[model samples]
Target: MRLLTRFCSSFPQQTTSVGARRGGINTHNTNRHYNSLNASSSSAADQVPVLDPSSLSPSLTRGIHVFNCPDEVGIVAKLSECIASKGGNILAAEIFVPHKKQTFYQRSEFIFNPANWPRAQMDEDFLKISTRFKAVRSVVRVPDLDPIHKIVVLASKQDHCLVDLLHGWQDGKLPVDIKCVISNHERGPNTHIMRFLERHGIPYHHLGTTKDDKREEGILNLVQDTDFLVLARYMQVLSANFLKAYGKDVINIHHGLLPSFKGGNPSKQAFEAGVKLIGATAHFVTKELDEGPIIEQMVDTVSHRDNLLTYVQKSQNLEKQCLAKAIKSYCQLRVLPYEQNRTVVF
Candidate 1:
């Protein structure tokens, strides 16, 4: 808990096509990038971009833009104008201006005739406004027109979250290409998972680690060319060096409500504490263990009648949904980094 091949946006990317071990065996890439626009590439005179007939959406296609920049007057007007100028209609806009903060955060969804506004031109338009606002983060995505995110999952023993993610991918509820699954533990209790990965042609790596060596090099080699990593209850703590090397976002699911029962066997910790509430937390992975910004959380009621196994079961169920929902949100371009260790998950 770490991923980019950038095209001027902050989100990580891969090919329009995904190979089996490269991401998925047969993931659906329904929308091909239709760059039919025959425009000369130039912003010298700041003219409108010419549309490519091939890339044109026969109907209005939805586009998403997430921006974080310094707050100032006329920001909204400029944003509106940027889209409106290109024959795009703003369907919804959400802006967050934190109190006593210089930061400005916005997530916008709009519909545009791709014939009038080419994909490349949209990027240029956003780039111009982003530069003017001195933005720290800027990303625009047309889910129907761009590559689906490619991700790798790291787990140790527990396959609840991992299994759920696999099912989600299969059901198409989670729009992603799972490059592979990496684990430092044996498949002793996870034989079915092994069979599933084998049958589906999804690569699964079993790299054993010890106190002397966490097998960082092997993990890095496997994770190369990925958009991001998911810690599906990957027990080991990822080192700062590994995260720095990867330089992308890492999402992890904590078994218990974070800041409460962190660092191993949280179910037992919560049980010992006699707490009535048990939950799971999905968040960005930082070098400081579970201290990263939370993206999603889910809770379930527990009482004295509940036993340790019951608590564990409930936590596992929550973890599966929490992690899956977080991944879905991230892939939809609905997540953005905000102020220190916090996120603007629209």
Candidate 2:
């Protein structure tokens, strides 16, 4: 997948907008450094750092921080200094400021040793900075600190995206923990996909939409603790009330270039239009119907040689890849919601 670019908190007192030079550093050490405020009554000024910088391990845990606030000077300098003072090493950083909105956006990944840097204290310090800047932010500490995002995928008769995600998760290509697969099938269970899921020890639920079946309600019950919901080729329109209950973490895959060729038979629409480009879009589901923040999109060339059937076949392939890519990016905490119903995936 193409590495798309651009893509959290509170504040406290005793913080000044001090200037510090900003530079980049690359390292692989997984150790996190932390010191607690309550661990000692002595001021931070009085305490000495006992860590021998050279003795630190090579592997490091990643802590990703995202910030959105009004555009200003010295924000990066202050943030970098705060992290450095806490013994955190910057790994990767990206920033953007929209001219029209005048909002500053930053996404940064840092590495630190927990034994040296107390996680609680680090949070407190970051919170202080956030409050000072009047910013909204989220901090995700990966591998050790952040919880594995639990996902429940919903699919219907179509199974290409579902199957691709299963294979990716089984092969360790997808990192999130998939809790279960829920399907709303009025007819019956799909034996092919069910058998594959059973072989992999993944739970499968077939919620039939018969008169006596409370399938939609049952599906809502299954989503209680899930971090997000994936609509993998699930051919049902979610009700606005259901979406409000689920929050904005629902992801959907559309089979054609969005803002055009939307709704059913998108491939047929594209063929009818004689469009040379066919694409798939993976986006967050909103009440607006296929008009949500797009996380990932992929397209390919089509021609007169391609008929309706061929167009659909090619578009289905793109759908699988695009949806999987969006899910993986989200699981890694690389997707950020931006203004104007857009997204930044790093």
Q: Which candidate number has the best lDDT?
A: 1
Tens digit of lDDT per residue, candidate 1, span 1-346?
A: 1211111123222211111112322223321211211223465354443344356566888898888798666676787788888888665565555545656767777779888899999999999999998988888999889888899999998879999999888888998899999999878535889888887889988899999899989999988888888999999999999988988888888977677888988888889999887888888888887877788888899988888898889889999999998888788777766546566666
Worst 10 residues of 1 by lDDT: 1-10
Tens digits of per-residue lDDT for model 2, 1-346: 1112221111111111112112222222222223221135367666544445346576545677777677666677777788888788775566655435556666777778777777787788778888888886555454567678788999888778988998888898887889999887632345777777778787888786654444667888888888888999887777777877766478899987677877777788888889998899988887778877778889999988988888888999999999889888777667766655665555
Number of backbone clashes in candidate 1 = 8
Best by TM-score: 1
What's the lDDT for residue 87 in model 1? 84
Give the TM-scores of the predictions, in the order they appear. Answer: 0.81, 0.79
Worst 10 residues of 2 by lDDT: 8-17
